[model samples]
Target: MAGHPLKKIQCESIARTSGKQCRAKGYLKKSGHYRCRFHGGASTGAITLEGKLIAYKNLKQFKNYTDEQLLIWIQNKLQKSSSV
Candidate 1:
């Protein structure tokens, strides 16, 4: 209460279990809406082209891997699992 007034704004989302409004403080979004951390207040992922490429690369199990290498890795994994 002694800080920014926005800190007092509660999340607009509801609690799944309690079926009541969430108690967490909300954060302002780009769309001018406030959402809590557990709700829609989290990061919206990478935005810039370079950021998107980095994010996409992070999705791969093996970073910096070529398509053929990934295929080989997958085939090796499949073979090992089938042998077991």
Candidate 2:
């Protein structure tokens, strides 16, 4: 996926957070968003510095979501994961 335009954000974010550029890629929790393993763990959404939803495919696509949203998604995912 190195030359894939759509995976650029994932690569950039990984580089920004890890301090080392990477080409690894994975599906964004839901569909459209993308993130490297280091930053991809049940994210709910990505926001701007002032706090605005920039992109979100699922509740697990963000690292910081509103309190209400976080509570609901966390509860749901936890329950589902446990059941599985």
Model 1 error, position 37 (Å): 0.9
Q: Give the TM-score of candidate 2.
A: 0.26
Candidate 2 lDDT for residue 51? 33
Alpha carbon lDDT of each predicted model: 0.71, 0.56
lDDT against true structure, model 1: 0.71
Q: Which residue window of length 10 is worst by lDDT in model 2?
A: 48-57
**Per-residue lDDT of model 1, residues 11-81, tens digit only:** 77878899999878888877777788888746767665456445555665668776566556656855798
- Looking at model 2, the pairs that clash are 43-60, 43-61, 43-62, 44-61, 44-62, 45-62
TM-score of each: 0.55, 0.26
Tens digits of per-residue lDDT for model 2, 3-25? 76773554335376668756666
Error of 2 at 74 (Å): 13
